[model samples]
Target: MEATETVLCSLLAVDLTDYCYRVCSRCQRVLPSDNNGLASSSFCNFCKSKEPKLLYRILMSIATDTSVKTVICFDRAATVLFGCSADEFFHFTKLNPLAASMVNQVFDGEMLRMTLTRPHNRNAQHMRVTSIVPLRSGFQPAIVTLTHICTKNASLGNCSTTNHTLRKGRAVVLDDPNEETQTALVADPNQEKSQKKGMILPFKPLTMTFHNVNYYVDMPKEMRSQGVPETRLQLLSNVSGVFSPGVLTALVGSSGAGKTTLMDVLAGRKTGGYTEGDIRISGHPNEQTFARISGYVEQNDIHSPQVTVEESLWFSASLCLPKEISKEQKKVGMDEFYLIWLRYG
Candidate 1:
């Protein structure tokens, strides 16, 4: 007999989850070999014996296909990406809104694409994520390729993570999607919009401000503390923008014009520690209060070897999202179509 790889959609869970549904009328009653096989099962001797293995297989398949980075059993994963680590991040953060959303689609026959900025340790940093839901449920990824969208090196990693220089073609890794989620998967009507185009951000501002920002060109403390003058810290520059939300704003200039400094300031990097100006987020331009909603993607990222495009997006989605959203809502949000353009920090 030929090796059997059950077409996932054609199979239904023996469990009483929504993953099992009636077959289309055109199909036969006994689990159709194609699109019409969802049904509840009353296990006999064979079913009872095979249940464990079958469920395991399904879960493994889900894990393999989910393709996200930094699967958080808790909120620690979120902190790791934000430079806040577990203890601090968990205290005051919500679930990563974007990653949580894509998890459903990945199981609902959606394939995602991820563009990571400043990738390292196979993590997607400052990422642009999108998804493509298949017309039929439980299909393979429609389009998959992970790229980059960034301005430049945005921040410094902790000592443990910095010594390692990033090499190209490293594979990103993440926890497998849960069986429970896959069992309850549902396709989104808006998936078409997200899949055909670029990534979606739940809340991004139109005009951003940078005030009292400072910058300097010096090697990290470890490398330059000796003999290197601390005074090399020059006031790189100060800048502010009236960038319209959902529109691209480009900062173009020569090598030494402080473009990196400007991108960092707008992103709330080292500069966030110093400045005060109102960044108008959507219509809620409190400048002072709502600025944390911004995203800062760098030029490189942590992409694992053999990680599919969709997996990369999932990783970014998880890290970028806010905690307030529910799992189902996240699925719908990430499924919408978008347009992504690259930035140079």
Candidate 2:
């Protein structure tokens, strides 16, 4: 039977073998690998792109008290458990054989609230884990815990396969035989500090003004039959407002007030209503660009239930940020917003 469920369960075991798969960055389809386990082509057959980047698709078999389920955790949920992206996790495991075992130890018997979905197809084997939240407070991700263990073992002369060093707040992996070193910086603490210092993304701020705004909808048949002679019912009349940048504006009104109607007209969000008004942005008449610059939040908003907050921010940054900004800058901007949200929200 197809079903979706939320359960409070403890992780009994986790299988780390074959934990990740490679997919085309453009189309997100599985890419075939060669004999050396490298992507066969730089071009994606599905998207027809010449320079196709690769991303990691993380999968795991997790056992709970009820049953053992193989689930596709995807990127966001997997990142929460690993404290790093799937690509970084794969690289760490390749450099050190004990990394996977250490991760298992870190996650074993952890309490979690999981949203699981079963496919409608009876032949499908794996259930999809839409979301994962650690039930315990002060939860540490696997990578951080493993890094600590590895560092401790190295200092005590117990680690033999690889050497660990901390350089510039990053974990550096040194191969013993050739003395070759690979450094992976999970996150920059200094950058986070700077974000906490109130760094904001650059944008051209504008002021919005609406004068003598009016909104109306067609009078219902029942209302017309009740001896109402008007052809249209007015929801808002003579609503005037000026909203400036960097200012918090409140629309204080009780039930049946025209606050929502005025906002809908100003934001060009009223779908079936007729609006008559002079709505200007920065003293200019409202244009198509107004929709791009302004946003309206409805009383009730809908979002994908499966997406985590981090994932939502990433998606919004990738899609809504200016195209001129580089990807790295966009990432930094997204992080700054995330920090602000956590602090105030």
Candidate 3:
């Protein structure tokens, strides 16, 4: 029989505390560890293997904005989010203490969208975190206002000028509580008329480009002390690529071929790596805005085991779709179209 499932969307109100786990050296099954956080130096009866390897097991307590908190016991979600197995995470932390510290900073004050499962005959629950999206506390209103103005200005044809003027007017109204904001948003009809009369071009497709990219990370002191000339290890060298709109690209390579390193560099996700090169979108350098507009999925199965298929669709639609769309329209699009197709198609 299948297990029951539950889905939770909440702020990670506390830190993700990690514990040491022991696994059989050969078979890789979890084993009991001693107080030193090391597994017994004896043979493992489960796999008849000798010795045990230490791994990192992550756990966290999460709460909604209302302060309803629950302690989540992690299974695969931690592995997916960390981009490595527990054993690999432990080893990586050991080798790169700086990188480990940088990673720890990602947890506090992030929004967690996770899925949980409950077995039929047991009280224990399991969880998988599908996403960890960082929320900048005070930036939403400004971002929404800018996006509205940009959309109005970029749309082609007869309505563009009127729409832009109206949006600017609305901005002035909404921003009236702040005197400086009101002054900044006051529309200029003269400028709008001049811009409209000159030229109006259709929206252009965005193309992301990276040229002659190189990335390196600091090497461990032990390696440098052992007479290694370079204190920094180069992960990628002279990589060049272009990703045009509507084109599908794949980065494929064997283990340690720097595929992930190159991707991380282009996505602006690498914090501990030393990078040098041009990464641009539509002739502009990539920035935090790139991260806001692009989505990257890690190679892990992350979904709420308890959420119904329809509930999952609703969850995404409500959070991801444009707020300008009416609630009725959004529901119709989901229930009448996307949900139906997903069920029968």
Candidate 4:
């Protein structure tokens, strides 16, 4: 058997036996058990509490693909996994059977990197699951934070060799792939070397700026055919702003304020709208290439209810991800998408 200070292992199975134990919430000590092998009281002998609150800790067995299994206990990683505290999880399981079932699904078939320490007994090694990492199949969550896990806030941006900027007084549609298909985002010269050294550098962020942006829908041709004068409906007028990188900008307005219409025009989703003014990315006119890396979710639930969540994510990843990404990588990306949706949906 191989022995090391740190072991990167995939979870083969989780032992649900003695999965949970009750402890005094104040003193953080295990409480007495009743005849049924369930926690009898929340009282702690060490602290001597008249009325005690209780909490639970989860313990499970984890292993590599072909190695001997070892027992590991959850700490803050429990909260990270389920995005809730242990007390909350206990209450959730008691209240929501479906949510408890969902929690159970996470234990098996997960990959983690563990740091190992040998006890005085020396026969078996104990390990703590320190951090989650990508599995051999490249399945890894794209964005995880203390507040949220597996969020869609992160996405791939389009790569272009030739830089384009927004020109003044231009309202050009950016979905024409034929015009900029030859260019791809060039990789940084240091990225390869850094990856080889097991470090990944963050990509450069793009800054989008739109000035005096306006959109109008022309009157129907049939309406103009009669003596009626041709007129256009202005959806957005003289909207100017810079969406700088690393800044949270909210587009707040009353109904019919054209917030949605402005977004549609920027995303190239408006087919019949006439646009004016300039939309620049990093001081250059944005072209069709920018659309390659852009992602947009409709405000309404327009997808079919019959389609499963997995199918929907797979469809999106297939279309949005770069062609160079392999099918296996895309599958991993979809796994991440599913995890995020489960928490946020």
Clashes of each: 39, 0, 2, 9
Ordered from best to worst lDDT, the candidate numbers read: 2, 3, 4, 1
RMSD of each: 27.8, 24.2, 29.9, 26.1
lDDT of each: 0.32, 0.63, 0.53, 0.52
Clashing pairs in 4: 158-293, 159-185, 160-185, 164-284, 164-285, 165-284, 165-285, 166-284, 166-285
Q: What ranges in model 4 sit over 4 Å off?
A: 1-202, 220-230, 302-345
Error of 3 at 231 (Å): 1.9
User: Model 3: per-residue lDDT, tens digit, 1-345?
Assistant: 334344333333223345655667787566655787565555677888777766455555454322233444433554435544554544544544333433322333333455554445453443434334323332121222333333443343212221211223221222222133322222446655555454433233455666678898898798888999987898898887666443466778776799877877788789886998877664457887787777776554355979997788777788767789998897788778866687899
Tens-digit lDDT track for model 2 on 1-345?
A: 568988654453345544454667766655666988777877667887665555555666443433444576666777887777767776777665555555554454466788988778754467767689987665756666566545544654543333333233322222232234322222345744654555344344455666678899999999999999999999998777666444576889765797777877787777897888777664457876678876777876456879997787777677666789998998888789878988999
For each candidate, what TM-score against the reference? 0.23, 0.38, 0.30, 0.30
Q: Between candidates 1 and 4, which one is better according to TM-score? A: 4
Full candidate order by TM-score, most accurate first: 2, 3, 4, 1
The CA lDDT at 281 in model 3 is: 64
Of 1 and 2, the candidate ranking higher by TM-score: 2
Question: Tens digit of lDDT per residue, candidate 1, span 57-130?
Answer: 00111111212122111112222122332333222112222232232322231222222223243432222211
Backbone clashes counted, model 1: 39
**Which is superior by lDDT, 1 or 4?**
4
Instruction: Name the top lDDT candidate.
Output: 2
